[model samples]
Target chain A: MDKPIRVLVAKPGLDGHDRGAKVIARAFRDAGMEVIYTGLRQTPEQIVETAIQEDVEVVAMSILSGAHNHLFPIVVNMLRERGADDVLVVGGGVIPDDDIPVLKEAGVAEIFTPGTPTTKAIEFIKQNVKRK
Target chain B: MNLQERLAAGDVRALARLLTYAENDYPEAEEVIKNLYGRTGRAYVIGITGPPGAGKSTLTDKLAKALRARDNTVGIIAVDPTSPFTGGAILGDRIRMQELFTDPGVFIRSMGTRGHLGGLSKATQAAVRLMDIFGKDYIFIETVGVGQSEVDIVKTADSVVMVMVPGLGDDIQAIKAGIMEIGDIFAINKADLDGADRTKIEIEMMLDLNENKAWRPPVCKVVAVENSGMDILLGHIQEHRTFLSESGELVKRRARNIRNELMDLVRDRVMEFITRETGKKLTVDDLVQRIVAKDMDIYSAAQYIMEAINK
Candidate 1:
């Protein structure tokens, strides 16, 4: 049997609201994937270390602190440094349209803004994970 | 491949990847688990739970550091809350334990409840198993300090620690009923506060009422911010581990945990299968219309759906 996709959902910086993160975690569980939430106020290094330690195929971060410009790139670079370049870097939470391309360029797989459905995120993961 | 071999070889990357696969309930995760299951039972599982502001994160950091000082490798699993809309976690535990991130002897992973109703995420057990396989002497599981669900999740630990603070008014009473029974060690953090003594007494009162025949859970006071009383807390943890081994309940408790995990996984899988099979043929609107028209009773309708799937 194939393994379910393992995702590390992280909140970076100091945004304390987690209602959306909790909802998405439930959605992924229902979708039959294993989801690990790294609680709030994480640094980029910690997020990458967690992804490496957990062997997560995807590292999805939720940042409402508007610090995505700094945090996302650092996380992407750290994953690369750890030779986890294959691990997908994705994020959500109040990212403006102008910054989406920059985030993608920085190696984030995709950026999810508000109103994105849980099913959409799950589907994106299912489609993109590098199958072992 | 054997888990011990994988771990002894220092394949931290592989160890983590395997844990992730296992936690997700992937079909392949089962084989990985079967291959590595016996390699587990060596690591001590400690569950840290309490109210939100009790500084559970800070205590976890101190404990990890203390355990490392004793020349033991540590694996920390911090369970955070998940975002509902995006299915992501607000991974906050790293803030308190950032110092340990660079330490070779320490590996920290923060996890979210991910909308699991029972307080902890389903992946937590698998993560613990992975940490065990990775050869950590201690694996610490910390939950967001809610109530019943947190207690339910921590029950899987080999030893459970309940953390409390002096200033979270009425929270002591609020946490009394469900958490009081499962705690192997009670920590009243922020002992520098005015009511620290009162909080300690309250915990003692609760502990006295629910004395265990096998082991007596101790109440210790600490100021987590200052790293006070950590040594005593570690001592109590070691004592509890000794109690488990000596009482012959270690294996029994582990077996029971395994049994519960298997049942939970089976239940989850069965529900998924039913949902997928039925979901294709029936919509919520369809059921509502049927009930509205009095064509079928709700229970019978459910039975009909189940029978269809079975057939």
Candidate 2:
């Protein structure tokens, strides 16, 4: 049987508001994906470690603490260092449109703003998540 | 030459990979566990849980260090809260234990609750089993302080330590019910604070009200930041272990835990199978519509769904 896609949803930095992250987690669960949520105030190293330990197909980071530029790339680099560069990296939460391109260039597959529907994110994962 | 043998020999990379395979319910995980299962049951499993800011992480670090000093290898599974919005974990538990990373004798992994209603991750028990097989002398499972669910998950441990701090305001009321009854040891952390004595007394009072069992839980005072009272706490942990073994409840409890784990795994697998078989043909919305339109009652609808799979 084909395995369920495993996704790690991480909240990077000092962001304390986790209601949104919880909602997305449920959405992914309902979509029949296995999700591991690392709770609030995670550093990039912690996120990478969890993603590796969980063997997730995707690492979706939600940062609302305005540290996305610092946190996101650090996570990508760490995952690469850990030989998990094949895992799809995505970001969400209040990212400016102009910054999205820069984040994408740094190895983030896509960035979702607040209003983007859960289905769209799910669909993106379905299409982009590479199976080993 | 199986994965379990490799794990038992202290192969960190293999252990990490095997744990992931197990977490995903991969078929090979069963083979690995089957090979390693008999090698387990040697380690002492300790569960440390409390509310956030109770200094659970700091206490865990201190405890790990103490264990390391005794030349006992330690395995830690820290259950961090998951971001509900993104289905991710902000795994900050490791921040306090960074110094142990290079210590070959200590292996620490942070796991997210992963939307499990229980405070601990669903994969936690399995991970503990893996650690036990890896020949750790002590394994500590820490929860993110959400209350009852945390207590339930920790019930699988051989000993449970509920950490509390002074000035938490409702410390007494919080420990009055549910998980409170399950604690084998209570630590009033931050014992240097003004209300530390009061918190200790409250726990003592609670214990006094309860009838004495063969093993009475002890309350210790500790300042985790300063690493004081750690020796006494370790003595209490050893005392608890001796209590469990002397009472012969350890084997019985482990048997029950194994039974519960087996049932949970079966239920999860069966549910996944049924969902996959039926979900392809019918949406959850379709089932809802059928029930709402009175075409079928909820039970009959469920029966019909089950019948569809059998057919």
Candidate 3:
């Protein structure tokens, strides 16, 4: 049997709202990916830790709290520092268009803002995950 | 580092990959398990199983929290059913376990029954071994405990806790399902409900009918959602663990489990070999056709395939 794509759907940084995270998690599961969801109010450290422990190919983070500017890069850099550079980091949920470049430069693979179809993120993961 | 070295050094990534390989039946799974087999036997595996909607997951969360409170590192595996059409699964057991998400002392993984593969219990065993090799003190395997087909938990868990709610009105159903014999401890969750005392008494009455029993299964009342009475349940689990160790039942049971594991592995390998050989050549189908045409018997055809494989 082939190993299925594993993704971690995490909500980081005091985001009490998890509706978006839950939706993405269901979408990922329906896309045939194994999704381990670390529920609300997770720190960047917790997200990265879970991503590594779950052996996820992608970390799809949903943060509506506007802390993406501070937390996203920390997760990307921590993944890099821990020799987990292959773990692709993606962000969504209320991220502004202007911060896209900075988040991309910080090593986030892609950012899906509002109205982005779940398939777009699913396709991105299928296309970009570093296959072994 | 190689996979085993990385896993031994507490690399969660390595551990996760090893489990994936094992669950998917990749060739590396065998090599990795073989290399790390000696490092296992440390983690005490506690299985939490009950009918769906029986508060098994909530109880699992409370139990993990209690175990963590004792400074024990915990690894949890929640097994849910797989979707046949998409080969996917929605493992939402962690919904109520949000608190453990950030706890470094805990590691959680969800597995789909993957009905095609037909070995959710075996996959769970491999996951438990990985956590054990990673030095977790306790491992929890939670499965939707319904029907005899899925009772594989009895074979896998060191001490099984059969969680029950107050309103499940079938005392004889548990016996029919063979859950009564396998439960090392019974937990009446949702004890705040109307039938709390009645449920406890019912299970006790059923247990009283059990003969030739050395250690009686204790029925502990708990409201897992409220985190009430968890300490008492944990105390019972610890007591059972102690009894198993001091009475040498632990060694004996583990030895029996090892035998079962070895036999299952042998069967899996033999079946793998047969499938590989049969896939390359259409021998099995041809034999079946011959049998259908009344030219050969099924028994002889099976013997012929076995002989060909041996050669």
By lDDT, who's the top model here? 3
Quote the lDDT for A31 in model 2: 73
Lowest lDDT 10-residue stretch of candidate 1 chain B = B168-177
Off by over 4 Å in 3: B116-121, B145-149, B283-304
TM-score of 2: 0.72
lDDT, candidate 1, A46-67, per-residue tens: 6777778767788888888899
Clashes of each: 31, 20, 0
In terms of lDDT, the poorest run of 10 residues in model 2 chain B is B146-155
By DockQ, highest first, what's the ranking?
A: 3, 1, 2
**Candidate 2 structure quality by residue, lDDT tens digits, A25-75:** 778876766676657777676677667655678998998978898889999
Stretches of model 2 off by over 4 angstroms after superposition: A1-132, B1-5, B170-175, B277-285, B302-311
TM-score of 3: 0.90
lDDT of candidate 3 over B96-205, digit per residue (tens)? 78778678789888787876332254577788888899889999999854544456787788999988888777677655646556789999988999988988988998
TM values, all candidates: 0.74, 0.72, 0.90
lDDT of 1 by residue, B1-311 (tens): 55446664767776765655655555555566667777877889999988787899999999999999999999888887665544555555766876786687988776666667555787888888778877899999988766544566555799888887786655357344676677889899988889888878777766666546578789899988899999999999999989889989888888888899889878987777776776677754577689889987799778867786687
Which residue runs of candidate 1 sit more than 4 Å off their true CA positions? A1-51, A54-81, A87-132, B1-8, B169-176, B276-289, B292-294, B305-311
Candidate 3 DockQ score?
0.50
